[model samples]
Target: MQSIHFISGLPRSGSTLLAALLRQNPRFHAAMSSALAPLVSANLDIMSSGQEVSLLMEESQRPAMLRALFDTFCRTTTEREVFIDTNRSWCAKMPLIADLFPDARVIACVRDVPWVLDSLERLFRKNPYENTRLFGNDGERATVYSRMESLARHNRLVGYPWTALKEAFYGEQADRLLVVDYEILTKAPEKTLRLVYDFIGEPWYEGHDFDNVEYDAPRFDEALGIQGLHRVRPKVAFEPRRTILPPDLFKKYEHMDFWRDTAGSRANVLATKRATREDTTTA
Candidate 1:
């Protein structure tokens, strides 16, 4: 089977752009997100139901069925040799993924919590004609405080992914994870991609042109009343802009990114070293 990896982390953290640049390599297959995780969850629920019929199935059957499900879902018609499945939920499913695909890795794209919320709010204002499904379809009409509260609550975008990423970061599967910062990725695409290639044990390809990459998910975004939510600009450069959020609201999450150390440097060195050691041993 072709190697499979996961792309997850906080929303509005450039997962789409990363996928776009990675897809530029003809040997790779990647997208904004996939339904495989939710599908697997739904199937597991059915099999684990307390009903007598469900109880009849052996415990071993569940894993085998899920393995088959992923194999079938990731199977492609093209010659793409690597599959990078994107989804924020995957951060919470690291244990399951580790058990299923022992060699698979998860590349988590992350950014400051305040900026992530700000990015979502900016998009909300840009599409004033329709309400986004993000906050129950009334995100635009909702007050800033209310919207912020909803997103910061546990199990939501800012909450769930942040908690999940941290869980995996400090958990036993930390070595199988790679945290990519939004600032570094946008400001230095080539350097970041090289690090990613090294982490995933893929041969480096210098053909990537971050400046002209194109990516968008109009159908998915439109269905959620978020027109350009998943869109990536033609260029990969980061243009600093003023925050649209209230000062208090922004301050509440301004210092919430836990992936960085006290000195504000990325703190996943241990995980990176482990990945390097594994790559070296395998190579």
Candidate 2:
């Protein structure tokens, strides 16, 4: 790929949909999360460990080695001019990416913390017959409260990327980050995509068909016992449904939306007006 960018942020946010839309541009190759980030971390750990062979790792070669990993992992996409790698860990690895791809931009797809929990809760409730891989033991999947708590732990699916996103948003490379609100994207996708194109400095792709968008990962979702986890509707209209969380639980995280309070904000946001505020409260 000639150019490399990143897509990352909260779970249940619009990263998957963004990828589905972006790949419409033949010059771009975008997809679900890849093993590249963890692979990079593992290699670095091995090289820096006290093992005798660790001495062979030259400091001068670290950048080349790390970069080659991307080159090799993305070798199949050579025909595509841009590769928008989607990995939540990329937000945590901003410093490394800064050193590797100076011109790269990271688009963070985000939603209010409570709404994020609510969406996950809806998925958990949708498959009551199958215990999800999202939580380990039966105890963790016992109720909406249990499931939400499990998913919000520091190392869990929702929290890790959320924490890493906050890190990138406040780090020295904050200028490289652009925060996209999920509500705004669903409310006004075309305008949102226009801003995204401008942020990544790509030519405006005016061929998007919002009503015909399609993306799904049945195998991936099925493996996790969540049939629609990565599913995107064929059309892109925002669905207005009451949330499924308990009232107290929903209110607990309502104020956790740090991205909304831009008192000293450095990241770009598209959340001036929330799209479906009237339907935000969960039933």
**Candidate 1: worst-modelled 10 consecutive residues by lDDT:** 274-283
The residue ranges of model 1 lying beyond 4 angstroms of the native Cα positions read 49-53, 76-79, 137-140, 262-283
Most accurate candidate by TM-score? 2
- The alpha-carbon RMSD values of the candidates against the true structure, listed in the order shown, are 6.9, 2.4
lDDT of 2 by residue, 28-56 (tens): 88887877778898887877759655788
Candidate 1 lDDT over 1-283, as tens digits, reads 7788989988888789889999998888988888888899888888887866577898889899999888888884345899889998887898899999998889988877777887777777778888777786465347888887888778776889889888877777877888887777877789899888888889998789977988888999899887887888888786666777787887787656566642333224312111100111000
How close to the true structure is residue 280 of candidate 2, measured as C-alpha lDDT? Answer: 35
Clash counts per candidate, in order, are 0, 0
Instruction: Assess candidate 2 and give its TM-score to the true structure.
Output: 0.94
TM-score of 1: 0.89
Clashing pairs in 1: none
| TM-score of every candidate relative to the true structure | 0.89, 0.94
